[model samples]
Target: EFNEVFFDGAVAAEVVGGEGDGWSVAMGLLALERGVSTLVQQIGFAAELERVVGAYVAAGSGDPVLRERLVRQWAELRTMRWNALRTLGTTGDPGAPSVAKLLWGGWHRRLGELAVEVRGAAATAGPGHWAHGTPYELGLDEEQRLFLFTRADTIYGGSDEIQRNIIAERVLGLPKESR
Candidate 1:
């Protein structure tokens, strides 16, 4: 694969990126599920984060309190990703993948919010209100319910279109694209 050749074939996990369907921690989840190592390096800002800290400390530009706050946020986000990896490799409620999905699922429904969160940039939304609902309310049959509860095979939490959009935009990072 191009990525393997580009990275010298050391990649054990791949963080899929796009403007939608961006299950941010999915690669880690995949790594865990496939028994691959997630610490193979260069997973997006993962490699950059420490350098960012170093640069900030060296430059000494930002306020100490502000830096501390940003660090805390980064810690929270990192922990969330870690939890996802942990869940996929575990069993039942002990896995706690649903908790991660519950939190991340909301982001898929609100791309504008994610744009703001990730890039501090404003983004517009289509004409639909998004809110989490139970599978029963969504008219999901047993199969869908089983899929939803298990967090298996996918990392989305809505209609097929919404799910596909999340897969397209976030996971694939395709901007303003269709199908």
Candidate 2:
């Protein structure tokens, strides 16, 4: 199940960004990934936010708490967009990527939460009743799926703790956490 590459020679000509410059190249790519990719994700987030807003409106639940949370989510999305743009334009900020990651991860996870919460108790129910077929055969609806899938958004690329550590040590020039 494993294979390996054999570079019989120096392969200097095949190196990217010249020889011994891999770190800078890697960081550049990471910057694009964290900054540009976040902008792309924001488009989808906008749609998701709209959907949540739609659900909230349709349900007509005059819950001030949910309304406040929804408005805050919208505002945060805008803030994240501007932050990502700032990170994209800046250089020499090693923690920029981490900040973007943290911003979107938690924002998206909360969006998922809001998606289901807007739908209320029905969010927990599958698309089909158990009497129609086995429960596993009945898949989740959009809100349900959103709620489940976004649970990992904060965990996959990096956890909140890791992002905070990157900000603390790299961006703020604080002392490193003891391992």
Candidate 3:
């Protein structure tokens, strides 16, 4: 049986900034324990994952195998997450309001794509990805939690570039740019 765990801001912060394998594993387990119904609540969790990856990259740990695995895992997870958000978008149930529907329709897609980009960047940057110091310094648990968490932001709903184009064309009604 699965239970839902509501993450307060502090817990969220801890999850995002945790460190090492132990913290990473614990965060994953916590997420899993929350079951599939909590996808909406878990958006922050996904963002945390992105931050964690940034931290790992910054730490100067030259583990190519680990990095590769992280990239693959993140991609797969992001796809699943995007699908979930997209599913939420199509449903107009009162429980799923229009604002959330609209947000999922585009914003979430962009985030998913961003996750993919970060993953690729992490791989390309390798150990040097975060060599210049990370934007924030989360604890080890939060760091690990975030690293593995953000894998799905890029590929599932839409990519960052795609989302930007969408906003330009649809919301702003700007003319399409030529490739």
Span of ten consecutive residues with least summed lDDT in model 3: 91-100
Q: Model 2 off-target regions past 4 Å?
A: 1-13, 17-24, 128-138
lDDT (10s digit) by residue, model 3, range 73-170? 46755765665565443423222222222334344344444444444454333342443477443323333333344444443334446556655665
lDDT per residue for candidate 2 within 10-94, as digits (tens), equals: 6877888989997789777877798888999999999999999999999999889999999999999999999988777677788
Best by lDDT: 2
Clash number by candidate, in order: 17, 0, 26
- In candidate 1 the C-alpha lDDT for residue 106 amounts to 36
Per-model RMSD to reference = 19.1, 4.3, 18.8
lDDT of each: 0.42, 0.86, 0.47
Q: Can you give the TM-score per candidate against the true fold?
A: 0.31, 0.82, 0.30
Cα TM-score of candidate 1: 0.31
When sorted by lDDT, best at the front, the candidate numbers are 2, 3, 1
Q: Whose TM-score is greatest here?
A: 2
Query: In candidate 1, how many Å is residue 37 off?
Result: 7.4
